[model samples]
Target: MLQGKNIHFCISERPIIGEVNIMVAPGELTAIIGPNGAGKSTLFKLLSGDLTCNRGEVSYNGKPLAGFKSNQLAKVRAVMPQHSEVSFPFSSWEIVALGMINDPAAISDRDIQAVMEKLQVWHLRAQAYNMLSGGEKQRVQLARVLVQVWKKQAFPRFILLDEPVSSMDVALQHLVLDFMNELKQRNIGILMVLHDLSLVANYADQVIMMKHGEVMANGHVSEVFTNQNLESLYGYPIHVEKHHEGLGLLVHSLPIHHINQRINKAL
Candidate 1:
């Protein structure tokens, strides 16, 4: 339902997110993967309407993005910013419930509670948001964002996430991605900026690779995360080796002998 057509965004006449075209099917989890400063965040902002694109158009269904009012947009799309520090001291439950507040339709406290439970932040419901650990705060914020768009059913809602798992631990990282995968299975459109190549390979149905504000590759995960694209993404050598359960893991460009030598030297 979300679509961007030849979208371009520039800062001071220098393009940041170059002309891009994307269509997110109803039940798809698409990952925007690229090296640091490749404008992945910039592209997401444009799609979320936080920043206007210099050219091209982003639309939802048959309606133009620019046509939606702020509240209207809020009901349709929710964005989780990259780095948010809880400057204001509020209860965790209060922060999470804020997501459903803006929603015009009345939502029950029970529904909000359910969302919090699913995010595993129910135990933190009464804690001060500002005082929570980074990962806790991230989970609370994520729960809030989800409640904002969740509604009674998962319609007219799309989530735009920027590095939601960056602060999370390894197990939590998989939990977050697995939750996102479940969202896609439930017909939710998730557009996320993720740095984990292995996770992307396992979970992402669509992958958009960027390099220096340009699209290096965009398509199915397997097609986009090839050895060449991974190398280009990091400006170095990389190899995709067969991995667990028919998956692929990206390895460094160094030869096996050199890898062993380095490991032996370290040992």
Candidate 2:
């Protein structure tokens, strides 16, 4: 498991993320959801060790994140930031291959091909990464992260992603998330920043809702995704209803004007 205890971060004496505690356990898909400026990405960086916190601790399994050497950490966790740029003319295949740079020999060409094909980017393998469409590039980057933790290890490993499907169409979004479900079977923990509440409602095993750098709610989706919790988190009149299609839930928000009329009547 990956855990953070009372994690805090600041800039110029102003806290960006403050006293946040979280746990990502193996075999679960944990999602962090919030409106804009909620410090979701900042918290993600702290957990990924991209940015050191001013106070508190982040650990993988039981070891402090700081204690792990670069190579060792690579084996335990793979991260996909919200934005990644490849200025050079690297081919899609080459970009994915970089994931195994620590020890390329560990993963074979066949395994690499399988990953690329699975992501529907095998045909784009020879194409320059910079030339691909936004959704295509996203898939390629995801494939890279997959390659890093492709082989199963004896201990738990993790993948940290931020707004992973923001650029994709609805079909692609479902495709990518479905594959994430498959990863859970391999005992790999997936922690991602998600903006789509519908996706969070349908797919996540656990959810963390944040606002103004604080955790508004966190727990199993069924608990944290209530109408009241969501309305408070988003500061809007939202509804959480049972999905007629299946066991999942459907979340929607009323128009601001409509909510104001109801509030006025109550007052």
The prediction achieving the highest lDDT against the true structure is 2
The TM-score of predicted model 1 comes to 0.89
Task: Tell me, by TM-score, which candidate is best.
Answer: 2
**Against the hidden true structure, what lDDT does model 2 obtain?**
0.92
Model 2 regions more than 4 Å off? 257-267
- Give the TM-score of each candidate: 0.89, 0.95
Per-model C-alpha lDDT, please?
Answer: 0.82, 0.92
Per-residue lDDT of model 2, residues 21-136, tens digit only: 99999999999988899999999999999999999999999999989998999999999998899988999999999999987877998999998898889999999999999999
Error of 2 at 177 (Å): 0.5
Q: Which ten contiguous residues of candidate 2 have the minimum total lDDT?
A: 245-254
Record all residue pairs in model 1 with backbone atoms less than 3 Å apart, i.e. clashing. none
State residue 71's C-alpha deviation in candidate 1, in Å.
0.8
Worst 10 residues of 1 by lDDT: 244-253
**Candidate 1: which stretches are off by over 4 Å?**
104-106, 152-156, 244-267
